[model samples]
Each structure stands twice: as C-alpha cells, then as structure tokens.
Target: NKARMSAAGIVGFALEAAPRTTRAQSMDVLSSQANIAGYKAVLVAAHHYQRFMPMLMTAAGTVKAARVLILGAGVAGLQAIATAKRLGAVIEASDVRPAVKEQIESLGGKFLDVPFVTDEEREIAQGVGGYARPMPPDWMRRQAELVHERAKAADIVITTALIPGRQAPVLLKEETVKAMKPGSVVVDLAAAQGGNCPLTVADEVVERHGVTLIGHTNLAGMVAADASALYARNVLDFLKLIIDKEGKLAIDMKDDIVAACLMTKSREPELTS
Candidate 1:
C-alpha cells in the first residue's frame, strides 16, 4: 500500500481543483459528493421544519403545501429541486446564469429572474463554460432585492450559490432572516465557503428570529456511508490515470489528468483571466 501511495505521489494534490475536461469529469469528486449533499439538505430541512412539505387533506382541514426556495442551479441545486419535488413542495430557484430558467422549470421549480443591465454584467452572468462568475456590485444589489422578496414567502430555503476562491455571496441577510415567518427553516450548503446567509454559523444549527438556520458544512458527511463510498470510488478511478496495468507505480506526466492532479511535481498554478 505504501509503495503504491508513494508511486502516485499525489498525496498533497488539490483534489478540489477544477475538473473541466471530459477525461477529468470522469473523476470529478465534487459532483459525486454534491449529488448526495443536495438530497440530504431537503431531508434535513424537512426534519427540522414544523410544517408538512406536501399539501394534506384530512377530516379536520386541508393543509397548504410547503414553499421551498433554492438558490443556485448547479448540480446540488438541481438535485435539491428534484428531491423537494418528490416530497411535493412548491419549488422556486434563482441563479445568475440566464439559461438556468429552463433547467429550473424543467424540474418544476419556478425560476427567479434577476435581469442583467450592462453588457459587461450580462457577459459576466453567463460565466466561463457553465459555472457562475462573480457579478459586479451593481448587478448583485439588483439580485439581492429580488431574492429578498422571494425569501419572505418561502417556508424552507436552501442556499447553494457559491463563487470559487471567494466567500459565498450573502443572499439572505440578517435583517431579512429576522423578518421571516416563525418556524421557517434555512439550509445553507455554502456555509464552508462563508455562507450565503449572513446569520449562518458554519457547522452549527442556529435558532434565531423564529427560524432555524442550518449552517452545517459538508451535508454529504451527514450520511457518511454513501458519501465515503462515492468519494473512494472517485479517488480510485483518478489513481488509474497514474497506475500501470501490472499495479506498479507509473507516473505519466504527459497525461492531462496526471499533470493537473500531480502536486509532488513543482508547477506554477495557471490563474488566467
């Protein structure tokens, strides 16, 4: 085991680095982990929530369906929409990407549109590839205004918007949270990235302003069995890029996956604009 570990020499590699290429996507650990995180987030919110997710008809009365609002239409956000839809919640989602409208509505989630003004802002909203780019302060203010209005009507809020190498933008502010209805619940998946909610405390459940804010980091970790299994599979598949068929150490620096993931070999990180 030590021999194989030493052969790869990828121990200190930043496994969380961007997996942009088709080959790299096969070993994308973030997506595997995020799939579970999104599913768990809804369950966690439902458990802590006082009201039922689905509308109920009983001898007594008809209970209204819970309103679920999701921020960001990434893998986790999409999964959260599907999971919540399964539970019969009326879902709404917001994202910077203009095309996310179709993705949200495809899963029965109403897309909250925050229109872009300037040409630069419009270009920025689309981002490089399919990921999110940080919007300028003016555009962000407009988004915050729209999000604040939507949050007030939501019974459960799952915030997943994240900007790489920066703190998660504050979507739900302290004042907004205080004004929400009693018994509302918020699951901030971006807590580890400094949280989309200002009130969130990383890895802690905060009860404030008649609402419960779950700032738990690594929601996938809550279900360790599945999370670890998927993570292990991803890591093992990535190792195949460096290991030979005879099960011997064979470092192939020419391989893109090997070159990007190789940390032991000193190389300057490319941070191009």
Candidate 2:
C-alpha cells in the first residue's frame, strides 16, 4: 500500500489466515468466522432441501435421516460435522489431512476413506502446519472419483476446501453434480474464492442437474452480530501484541507477528548510531 496509495500496509490476515500456529489460535479470524459459517451452512441447506434432516416416526410413517457429506475437514468442516450431528443428519466427511479422520470420528461423522494414500500423497498432504497443499494430478483424479460416488449418494453436501493464494480447488465436477439425486443441496463455503464446485456461482444459489447449489459469499453474515464480535475480538487481541506503549505506530520488525503483518513501511530506516 505504501507504493501506489502511499499508505502503510498491515493486513489483519497476517494473524488470521491458514496454516494455523498454536500461539495464534485465539487470534485466528479464519477459524472464528468459519465456525459460524459451518453451522450456518447446514442450516441454510436444511432450509432449501426438500427433505428433513432428522428421522421422524409420525402418523405419516418413518422418514430416514438425510445423508450429509462434508468435504474439507478443517475447522469449518469439523464444525459442519458437529452441527450436522446436532441436527441428526447421518454425516460423512473427507479431507487431505490424515489427522482429520480422527477429528471427523470425534465429531460423530464417518470419514470417507479415499484409496489414494501413497507415500508421495502423504508427504504432500502434510502441508504447512496441518493444512493441505496441492496433490499430484494422479491423486486428484482418485479423489475426484471417490467424490463422484459419495456425492451422488448425499442429500446435503458442504464443500470447504481452499488453497492459499489460488482459486479454490474444484472438488465436484459438473458431471458429478449431474449425477446427484434430485432435490439434493450443495453448499459451497468457498464461493468467494472461486468455489469448490465447478458449477458454483459466487454469492448466489443456482439450480442445476435437479440439485440446489448454495454458493452465497460471506456466510458468516447469516449470523452477523456474533461473527463480527468474534472477528473483532481476534483482531484486537493480535493488535495488542504489536502496538507500543506510547500508542504511536511502532512496529518491531524483530517480532515475528509484526514482521508478518506488515506489508509496507513509509520509508527506509535512518542509519543507526
């Protein structure tokens, strides 16, 4: 920002983006916002879906619970599993992180096991600080195949996978979507970042292949007050670590948090004595 606009640049995302560190967890805006998004996604899907999430034995007879498949077992994915469980949906989830299997199970969600676990796949999957890096083309092909079968059987699908600085990876292809049952729902939480489904249109719900794809951006908006409160508190907490006692902007480059947040400075430092 110091170049064109001639302004100092320090981004809030410096403390909030992916590849989470333990010390920065309290200040992670991504997780805070994602928690809200995940829960809201399930609710949104339930609203649009033609079926019920929980089984009911009434005068109308028995109703089977909806099948939910959540892609990307990150904080959002985990929360989605938990929320769906609370809603009584039979849930399954998939992610590149091997660690996510345990996480999904802990949330009472079944893990969809993809048979593409090679040494190379494992190495790449163990990305920076438990995040997922891009896998090989062969691995992606296998993942797509697995998703096709699972997505076809799902009544509600929520996709949360995303790659940093790149467009969100497409997990569900158009053909796979076409194969989904009529009246099914797919919520793409990564819609603003180019979506996890090829058919997603950012910030809009579209009907295609007899299914509803919810690609609404900023899903945290559904719970705006709570989401904003959590995100603001995180930003404030991170700012406290960097701001000097005098109250003037004094960035300590020696501090990792400061160094990480600053994108530009006014000018080069004056020579030291």
The number of the candidate with the highest lDDT is 1
Q: Which candidate is the best by TM-score?
A: 2
Instruction: Report every candidate's CA lDDT.
Output: 0.85, 0.84
TM-score of each: 0.90, 0.92
What's the CA RMSD for each of the models?
4.8, 2.6
Candidate 1 clashing pairs, residues 3+ apart or interchain: none
Poorest 10 consecutive residues by lDDT, candidate 1 = 264-273
Instruction: Report the C-alpha lDDT of model 1 over 1-273, residue by residue, as the tens digit.
Output: 434555664344556663566777767888888889999999999999998999999999999999999998888999999999999999999999988889899999999988777899988888774579988999888888888888899999999988877888888998888878899999999999989998899999999899999998979988899999988888888878666799866666677666666555323333121
Clash number by candidate, in order: 0, 0
- Report the lDDT tens digits of candidate 2 across residue range 39-100: 99999999999988998898979999999999999988998999999999999899987778
Q: What is the lDDT of residue 126 in candidate 1?
A: 80
Off by over 4 Å in 2: 5-14, 17-19, 268-273
